[model samples]
Target: MTIRVVLTDDQPLVRAALQMVITDTADIEVVGEAEDGAEAVRLTAELAPDVVVMDLRMPGMDGIEATGLITAGTGATRVVVLTTFDDDDYVYGALHAGASGFLVKDMALDDILAAIRIVAAGDALIAPAVTRRLIKEFTRPVVSPPRWSELDGITAREREVLTLVGRGLSNTEIAGELSISIATAKTYLTRLLAKLNARDRVQLVILAYEAGLVATSQ
Candidate 1:
């Protein structure tokens, strides 16, 4: 299956460069390109790509707000935030806002492509330390919110899967831990991701942390 993609960044050269790299992959296709956040949203709605490569510093909408809007409105489209700044503040805000993946611009093209493929396959995320740095910088000391009764509909096993996900455990690891098959673990993750209003495992991880589902795990 072709993984349709959208590239959103203010700089034309940057967008072109990313396009060249992404288009090199046989399974990935650039469906659309946007110059700013609003255009990103607009193009996203129109093209309904499988993934979005977004820049945080764009004018008009910014990646954080764009990620929130995109995830909330079109849960089918996964977002991968790209930026020059791996600064904790930007990374945390983008993930909290609902990005499916986070990549530093300094990362090699291969690394960025791997991120896109990981999220496109279903649900994937960056390293634990990457997520933790952002979390510590952005997560307020405020008390965690109570789990809504809606979440109670999820099974205890699902909760465990969620915890593992938030802890940055891959489906293979979750399967190994639970003594189950990878397919079963991924199925559980898919159901939990759908139920939690999450775009992917990455967003679920953020939610798990935000709602105190997993502590000292990120």
Candidate 2:
């Protein structure tokens, strides 16, 4: 199935580059382009593309707000935040705003395409470099207390899975770490998602951090 995509970036060069690469892919196609967040939202509503590649900063609205609006307003279309800035604020903001994927501009174009595909398939992704920083950032003591209630209904095994996920381990790695099969790892992940009401893996990572399942030294 073809995955329709909308490119939302203020830089024409970035959009053009992405479009050029995406057009070469048989499964993915660029359906629309937006220079700002508002236009992105409008285009998303009109085009109903499978995914939107959003930029963090724009003249109006901004990617975070647009991401929230797109995800909240439509169940079919997902947002992938692609930006030059990997600042902690932008990372947390985009994830909190319902972005299905978070990537930095410095990543290879092919990886970006893969991320779009992953998100279009109803999964979530975050760049490896960004994920490491995200873990470290969350390790710092916060002014507010951790939300332990979020993990109330989850089992101990599910909490283990969430901790591995927060550490950016893949399913295979999680399975290996826990002496389980890959399918079992996936099942635990799925259960965690449902039990925690997480939107995707990214949110699970955030929740794991918020619940203090991930430690600073680890």
lDDT of 1 by residue, 123-198 (tens): 6655666555555555544265646564777999998888787676777888999999999998998899778876
Encode model 2's per-residue lDDT on 1-218: one tens digit a residue: 99999999999999999999988999999999999999999999999999999998888798989999998993589998876554656657887788887767888999898889999999987544567776676345444688898788888888888888988888888899999999999999889888888889888887777777776666
TM-score of each: 0.79, 0.91
Per the 3 Å backbone cut-off, how many clashing residue pairs does candidate 2 have? 0
Prediction-by-prediction clash tally: 0, 0
Q: Scored by Cα lDDT, where does model 2 land? A: 0.84
Q: Which candidate is the best by lDDT?
A: 2
Best by TM-score: 2
